[model samples]
Structures are given as C-alpha cells and as structure tokens.
Target: MRLASTIRGVTYSFRSIKEVLAKANSHKSGDVLAGVAARDAVERVAARAVLADVTLEELRNNPVLPYETDEITRLVEDDLHEPSYAAIKHLTVGQFREWLLETSTTGELMRSISRGLTPEMAAATCKLMSNMDLMTVGAKAQVVVRANNTLGLPGRMSSRIQPNHPTDDVQGILISAREGLSYGCGDAVIGVNPATDTAESTRDILMALDEVTRKNRIPTQNCVLSHVTVQMAALDLGAPMGLMFQSLSGTQTGNEAFGISVSLMDEAWAKMKEMTPTKGPNVMYFETGQGSELSSDAHHGADQVTLEARCYGFARRYDPFLVNTVVGFIGPEYLEDGAQITRAALEDHFMGKLLGIPMGCDACFTYHARMGQDELECLKVLLGSAGVAFLMSLPVGDDIMLNYQSTSFHDIPSVRGLLGKRPTPEFDAWLSEMGIWDGGKPGPRFGDQTVIR
Candidate 1:
C-alpha cells in the first residue's frame, strides 16, 4: 500500500513500506549507494511524517520480505508475545514514540513489552528518534545474559578483550589477552578473531585462552571468533569452548551469503549447550552491523537500520551472551563519516535493546572513514551513559588484525570511572583479588601484562 504525507504544501508518497523505511533513515551512505536513500531532505522528512502515522499492525502485516518467502519473517511472527502485542498494536508509530519517551514508562515496563515488538516496529521506532532521543529512551530496557560471567546489569558495564592476531599465533594472542586482563578489560570475554579460520587453528586458540583463563582462575569466558562450522568442528575435537561465536545477518538471503542457516545455528546452539564448558544459559556471542545485508546484495530494498534490527531479532532466539554492532567497520561507503557512524551506533543500540537483545558497540572507524579518533572517544562516553551491555576493548584502540580502530584497554578505566559503571560481578571481584583493580580504581599491577600469569 502507498503511504503519503504533506510537508510545506508538497505531498510526497512512498510506494511501499520498504521505500518509507529506506527514505526515512538518517543519511547513511550505504542507503544512498544502494539507490534507496531519499533524493533530498524534504523527501526524507516527508517519509518520516508518513511513517509516524503507520500503525504497528501495518508494519506487522508488511514484513520487509514476504512472510511466506522468508524464515526470518516467520520466526519473528511465530515468536511474538501475543498479549503484549495486543496491548499496543493499535498505536501509531508516533504514539509509540511518545509512549517510550514518557517518564512513566519504566525500564521494567519496557522489558515486559519488548517481547511484543517485531524487528520492523523496532526499526521504525528508531528512525523517528534523534541521537539523544535514542540514548534517553534506550537506557530504559535492561537485558541481562550470562555465560561464565554475567552482563547487562544496571550500574555495570563490561568489555570484550578482542586480542586478535594476524598470524593466528597462540602466544601473540595470549600476550594481548594478558595485557587486556591486567587493564581489567576481559571481564566480559576474551575473544580472538583468527586470521586463519580452520578447526586446528580454532582449537589451538581455544585451548590457549581456556588454559590461561582457567589456570589464572579468571571469572570470565573465552571464544575464538571463527565460523560456526569451524568452531563446531573444534568442539567435536574436544576443545574447551567458553562461548561459541558467529556473525549474523538480518535476512535469510544475507545469512545464506554468510554460509549460515537458522537450522545450522540451531544445531550449533544445541551442541554448545550440550558441550560448552561455561556454566550458563547464555553461551553464544554474536556480532552484527548495519550494511551487512547490502554488502551481500541481500538487503531486499530495506534500509540498513531495519536489516540491522532483524539481526537482533534472530539473535534473541539463541539467547546470546553478548551482541554488538561493529557499526563503522563496514567502511565509509556505508557509514560515510563520523556523523553517520555516530547516528548508526546509537540507532543500533536503541533498536537492539528495545527488541530484547543484549546490545553493545565497537565504536570504531576504519582509516578510510572520515571519522577522527576524537568522535570515537566521545562515542564511548555516549554509549556507556546509555547503559550499553559492553564495548570492544583493543590494545590502544587499534585492531591490528582487522585494520580498524575501536575502544582501547586504557579507555576502559576512564569510561567506567566517568560513567560510574562497574564490570560484571564475578570479574570485578577477580580484578580486585588479582591486584588489577581496587575499590573502583586501578591497582598496583594495572598495566602489567605479567600479572595474570
């Protein structure tokens, strides 16, 4: 059905829900690259105006992809909380936006109603929100998940120590992990992105992280960010898997491009539950971002924000321990600059939390992106204040392996102290006991990589 709105005496009409969503999104280079972005600011505002009047039921009825043709659509519809949906399904998107911003809307209420929200509704809600609006309302939803450690607690923040190695060398990776631990950054998980994606390489990396964390008695988990199939192969070889990791896409077609199926992920999650060494209901770690679907030619005329939201919807099914958007890693073609990156980071966090996903951010930019290091630093403070679940912590804000910039180990202390947040309960105690952190301050061995060993 066509949707139309008048602005400044001009009526702009959108042919479909997809067009409305794509045009209404904050200016993302990827949308423009995809030739789906609005031609001008007036059309963009008109699209938002039309979208605000779109009822939740209308969004539900029109999945970005046809329900019969897409499993993701089916999965979203099949799993919705019926009573919660019935309560506010009649409200137009504008009313829902107002409802969220109201002071009476508590975090508990947000949590309770989250199950009723579809990814599309979550997407539409975010499009109409300003940067501060995203942060202000996003802080209301609390999503707690656990593996060897817990995350997403109120007054708490965590950091995933991404000790990536270009050569997949276990020793090089361990040194980085040890360094991160000394800085109190691995309380979330010690995750490694392997340059070599293979069973043996994954198994070796997994064993190394497992041995180090276990021997040191660190109260955290570990994961080798390899393909799910490779990790599964390593698990079959009896590698100690703390948390299984995977990259997810918003559409079935996009997931296929990643060489994954819902069934494969289901099998992987079941296998991890049956065999993972971690003690928890949450054992999966997932990474998602805007523009992944478009990158794979699977966006299906939808905007990056909506496609990104669908990833959270799919991820919630597996009960992931950690989930984040590597917001700018898709590069300048998608995010364009610091402003675009900032907009995407907030939008992703807001949509993820509203849809009941434990959300975090990489807060990064590639060298080619027009963003400077300054904006990245401000982004960390912004997300931390917004009650994000976690942020990626690298050695000096640079991922040597991935060739991008992100939050650093040094940034962890200031973020926590400035934002008045703490690490997960178990990891905080371990940090204190290990002489790495003391009473909300860095301890004597704060930057000593040798402290853990």
Candidate 2:
C-alpha cells in the first residue's frame, strides 16, 4: 500500500501506491483528506534529503547499517565527561559491583552511560557481563515514574497485559479478552488490531470493548489499533477515546508515512485529553519497534537501537500513557539471535526508563527468526526485574493474527511471583473482588486448568 506521499515528488508504499492511497482516503466522509494532504506536504520535504541517494531496494535489503566500533568507542569516551568518570576509570569490576550495591545514585550513573553508548555497543558490552551483574544494574536502574492516568496503568513495578485480537471478529476479540482477564491480566489495556482498518470497524470494536469493560467492571483502557485518521473518524462518530493508539518510528520520513509529526501528535494528544474518560490515566498508547525506520525507507545511517531511542524521545513529548518496544518482532535480520534479543530488550527498558518514559517490552520473535520460548523467558525475567511497565497478552504465548509468541497469561503470575510484584493497583482490586486474585497472589486457578469435583 502507498503508505506515504509528498508534494516534493516522492512517494513510499508498504505494498502498492494505489492500495495505500485508497486506504488513506477511505475515510473521506470524516474529512480526513485535508489532514492527509497536510501530512503529505510536510513528509515530502522531510523525506527528500534522506532519499536523495538511497534507493528503496537498498533500504529493504540493508535494513541495519554495519556497526562502527571505532565510532562507538569515541562516543563512549566522550560520554565519560562527568563526575562518575573517575569512579568508572578506577574501580575494578568487583569494586564496581560493590559500589553499585553501596550507592543510591548508581541508577543515575548507569543512565548516563546508557545514554552515551549506541544500542549495538550496549548489547555487545552486556553480552560479556554476567547475568547477576546485568540484573543488578537493571534493578538499580528502575526509577519511580508514572504515566499519571486514572486506570492506574503501570502504577507499580509490575507488568500489564495487552491481549490483542484480529480486528474483524468482535466475538473472538471478547473471547480473547475474557481469557486474559480470567488469568488476572489486561491491566495495561485490552487492545486489538482491526481487520478492516476503517473508521466504522474501529468504532465498532472500541464501543464493543467499552461495553465489555463496563459489564465486567475491569479497570482498564479499551483500544482498536487503526490508523490515526480512522481513529479520528471514530472519535467524530462518538466513540469513547479511551485509548489513542499509534505506531511511530525515529525518522521524519517514517513519522510522515505513519501520518504523524510533532504538530500532528500534539493535536491528537490535545483532542484525547479533552475527550478521554476522566476516570482513566492518560489515553495515549504507542507501539514502536526497531527496524521500522529502515522498513519505511527512512534510516539515516544510524543504528537501529539509536533510532529506536530517538523514537522514545519523540513519544515523550506527548507524555504518553504507554510506550512499548516490540523488541524482537522485526525479525533476525536486525537482531540475529536470542542473545541479541535479550540485550536489546534490556537496553530498550533501560534507555526508556532513563528517558523517564513509561516503557514496556513485547519480548517476542517470528518463527523465521530461529528464536524460541526459552529465549523469551530469559528476557521476560530480566525485564520483570528491570521493572518494565507492561507486556503483551497472547493466549498461551501465541498470537494467531500477528504470528508471534510473546508473554502469555500464565507468565504474569510467574514473573510477579519471582519479583513479589502485583498488577497495577486498580486492576489488582478488581481481581481481588472477582476472587481471581487474593492478597497479591494468583488465585486457586493455574494455567489452562480448571477445578473439578
């Protein structure tokens, strides 16, 4: 589909230009054409410089640039221009461990160092460290930041559930949601990727979810992941703006194709702020993954992780309620194996926390990526310790529509038990009232099993 167009004589497509343009204009009745036209003009100019020499074929074939070790070294050295530089230079690894354990400001120091290195370098350095050391750093890196919303989304150091369904089937969506909630999940938000990607379909799903939430008395946000234009149409049609969803990337060209810019995002944020249910936290939900810039033909020779951090910086401007990095979802082309995925997930959480953004990790992989459940489990535990804000809720760890395996309903209690954490405050109360959770522990039910006489 033609995902982006510019008046500067450039066009970009996810499939074909006709298909994308058709989808873009499908909500003309809602007056989305004007917004699309304005976005096209801004994106055309923003993308012109990046596409000057690179071909779309090159971008597709070479999604990630080769890492520059020398450049990374220079950047790391430059970043040590702070008070912590002396301690880092003089302390032995053991002494560093002791110091990390002894000091309250280690998180501040680690955040500074993390901001200094590119994600590639951070991953490489972490691979050589022991898991204990990694965990120690990650645990200390947790800062008490909140998204400031009513649903109490991510009010603790625990993970939230994101049970996503294929957009076409309302019944199937509710079924998945019920399955997740039965396991005491969906504290993050019960969201779906709409099949039709139209305003009517999006509105229908949102309204359905709202009704479900009210009936069940689940203290969570409801969302249908459609294009922003389609979502605006749904809002115009009186759909509750419970959760405003968007996928963003680092580069200007990428944001353009996604039909987002600083101005556009600000506009959306204002609209949601004015209309969202007063009883919930902030209404914005954003999904970002590394490699999106390259996928959109917008990489400017920066490392994927670096670009991913830039995307977080952009999202922070809006003070979004939830920001999730689909850490390994892009595939092996960007991150080669389980170890790479693990490090990338840690780096994303660490970086996002340092940036003061409420962050979550979709610790998952595609089948072709040669990753497995064991790798996902490893990353999940590490992120759980790192105090990630939330996780994806796939029934039994498998997403039928997205074709990936992520954290499952069963994984929630497993991680919380390991960390002595519970779901967000409001959801925890709801779970307790439902007799699904007792005193911050999973109720008598476990996994896919039910009791019998």
Candidate 3:
C-alpha cells in the first residue's frame, strides 16, 4: 500500500500500517515510549494525511496481524456482515469520517453500517478526527445492553457502583453501594474489584452484592471484577453472579499474558450462562485500556488505538453488557497527563460505539500523573456530553482498592443535572420511589444511604 505523503513540500514515508497508525495518532506517551510515535508534530500531521487517503478495503485486507495468524483478527474479519462491509469498504478514511459526521447520517444508519466496519477501519477513521469529531460521531451511535437492567439508552447515563474495599469487606462494599444508590447511581451494576482473587473471596463478595441487591429490591446487577478463572471457580462454588467480568486484550499474545485465551473465555461464557443467576443475552462485562498489549509485549508493533479497537472486536464476540477503558490508570507513562487521557477516552468511546458495543470510561488518574481530580472531573464532563453509556462511581471518586481517582457517587447526579440526563428507566423509577430523585434531579433523600430501608 502507498504509505507516504507530502505536506508543505516535505515528504513523510511510513514502512508499514503499524507505523502509519502509530504516527498518525494524537500524541500519547505509550506510542512515544514504544518508539513508534511521529518524531515531531509536522510528521504526525503528515501521517494523518497519508492515513486519510487509505481505503477501508485496504485496512480490512491488511490487519496489523494477519487474519490467519491472529484469532482476534480472524474474529474481527469473520464476523463482518458482508453486505454491510460492501456499503462502506470503498470509502477512504477521510470520506468515512465525513460520512459519519454528515447531517443525514443518523444513529440507525451508523448502526447499520457498523456491522461491516472492521476495528482497523474504525481506528483509521478515528485518526482523522479531532476531539469534537470523536464526540459528535460517538453521539450518533446507539448501543443498548441488558443483564438485570438496561444501559446505553439515549438521554441516560449509568454508573457501576464500585464498592471496593482494601480488605474485601462485604459490609463496607454494601455501604458504598447504598451511598451510590442514594444518589441515583448503580443502575448499570454494582461491581467490585476484589483485593484477593481467591474463589472463596470472590464468592462471598458476589453473594453479598446479590443479597443486598435483592434485599433492597434494587433494580440493578452485581459483579466482582476478578480473573475469568477465579470468577469461574466462584461460579463453581455457586456464587450468584449478576455479570461475569474479565479484562480483554486485542492480540492472542496479550490474552496469554492475561492468562486467558479465546477458548478459555468461551468456556467461561458457557459457564456464566449455565451458573450465573443474571438474565441472559448479554451476560458479561469487559474492561480494556490502551497500552495493555504493549505492556504485555504483544502489540505486534501497532499503535494503542488500533489494538484497543481490536479489543472491541474481541468483545463483540460475546456481546458484553458493559465495556469500558480504565483510562489513565496505567499511569503517566502511557497516557502522560490529562490531555492524553482525555484524547484516549474519547477515541475509545467513539470506536466502541462505531463497532456496535455499549461503551463507558473510568475517566481516572493515578496520583503520579501530572494531573489530578480537576482533570478527572473535566473528563467526566466531556464523556457525559459525548453520550457515554456509563461511568464508574466510587464512594467519593477514590477507589481505595484500585488506588485511583474515579467519578464519585455525587459526581453522577451532578453530571446528570448539568447535562439534563437521568439514570436508567428502571433505576430512575426506583430512585423516585425511594424519594431520592425527582424532576430529573436529586431530591430530599439524595445522599442518605439509609434509604435502602
């Protein structure tokens, strides 16, 4: 493929698709550290110029990993609805971006075309978009998923009550869930990242979340974020699961690093279906982030965004109920600071939606990053304005177990109020019934965890 461009009389040439994608990406510390990033701003713009002219057909035909070698690539290619791909495969990346942003391109139309688009095509189109472009295009797509409740409905923003404790305390977890519920959060699900991944610890936590969910008649789901194997073991011990959880990667090598494979996950899917008490069709939740594959030495020379899109392709195999990037949690080395995190979060949400999946973000930052809570709040606002499906909520935006700052229980209603959004229909009804939400805003009993009574 032609991988060179001339801008301002300077010609920039790239040797491969990997280089093209890496250089074309907006600045990110991960790509730079990988030594794949553009050497300078001028070259970066030049790469975008070259990438913009590449056709979707070229991208589909030339995955970063050959389809025959990479199961993730095979899954991405094999699942394409041929008719849908044919409709847009002829368009250049620049043309595709324009089509997506066209006033006539409704959400329904995007969904129809989405089935044909490959992750490479999505990432390629993303490279040509600005921050606002990503938001506007992302807002034009709709993807809804349901387990115990629904998510991704328009005019709705949901939260996963991350009641994580340092000691795996069930009561502490329940207390956090109750506080989140008081502020009209937890419509998406109440999920926990256990400090320990033992089958017993996971089982107890899952059963506790399930108990509180039922006892309070909360219209939500519950899950413990553990390794698929650990969760599988817990399911074997009869842990009542709401949504089985796992972290995903784009390449098989990366999956291996995570101690999972396609077959292993397929087995887990079947097990969750057979054992978990949660309702079906969408029975899994997945978390993915940029730099994971590189960190695992499995990036195959690709940029983070391309690999990340492949994650959505991989996730598409199971039709997960929820998928989000733990943005900025990887620290400043990969994302650098608030600007890079903001860019990655928007790109991830946009790509996931374009590929037809429910997408959310953990819009968080590590303490060592050159950013802080103010930057995190800025990201939360941007995601809310971009029509994100959900965001993670902690006691006060501090995940003690995970050691990162995320959205707080109060941030949920604050964003909802600012954007004139509400929780899921089921949870909104429950919130109103409990006197904690009214007229699209917090009511008399808003921050009272005692409302669980």
Clashes in each model (backbone N, CA, C under 3 Å)?
0, 8, 0
Model 1 misses residue 133 by how many Å? 0.8
lDDT of each: 0.92, 0.61, 0.90
User: For residues 1-453, could you state the per-residue lDDT of candidate 1 as single tens digits?
Assistant: 459988878889888998998899999999999999999999999999999999999999988999898889988899999999998899999999999999999888888888899999999999899999999987888898888888999999999999998999889999999989989998888999999999999999999899998899998999999999999999999989999999999999999999999999999999999999899899998999999999999998888999999999999998888899999999998999999999999999999999888999999999999999899999999999899999989899899989999999999888999988999999999888889889888899899888877
lDDT of 3: 0.90
* Candidate 2 per-residue lDDT over residues 1-453, each given as its tens digit: 123434547554323321222232211111121122214434433332222222222222222333242222232334323453433443322343445456576666665543332332232223223455555555666443333223223225444445555557887777777777778777778778776888888888888888878877777777888887788888888887577889987667778778877667778788777777735345687888867776676655444555676566566666667888998888776665787677677767755665546778889988877678887897888888777777777688888778887888888777877877778787788777777788757665533222200
Clash pairs (backbone) in predicted model 1? none
Native-vs-model 2 lDDT? 0.61
RMSD of 3: 1.1
Each model's TM-score?
Answer: 0.99, 0.70, 0.98
Candidate 1, residue 40: how far the Cα is off, in Å: 0.9
Off by over 4 Å in 1: none
Model 2 root mean square deviation, Cα atoms: 14.2
* Tens digits of lDDT, candidate 3, 1-453: 789998888889899877898899999999988888899999999999899989999888889998778889888888899999999988999999999999999999999988898999999999999999999989879898888777888999998889899999888888888888888889888999989889999999988778778887888888999899999998889899889899999999999999998889899999888887777679999999999999989998899999999999999889899999998888888899889999999999999999999999999988898887787888899999999999998888888888888899889989998998888888888888889998776789888889885
- Candidate 2 residues lying further than 4 Å off, grouped into runs, are 1-102, 106-137, 141-162, 278-281, 444-453
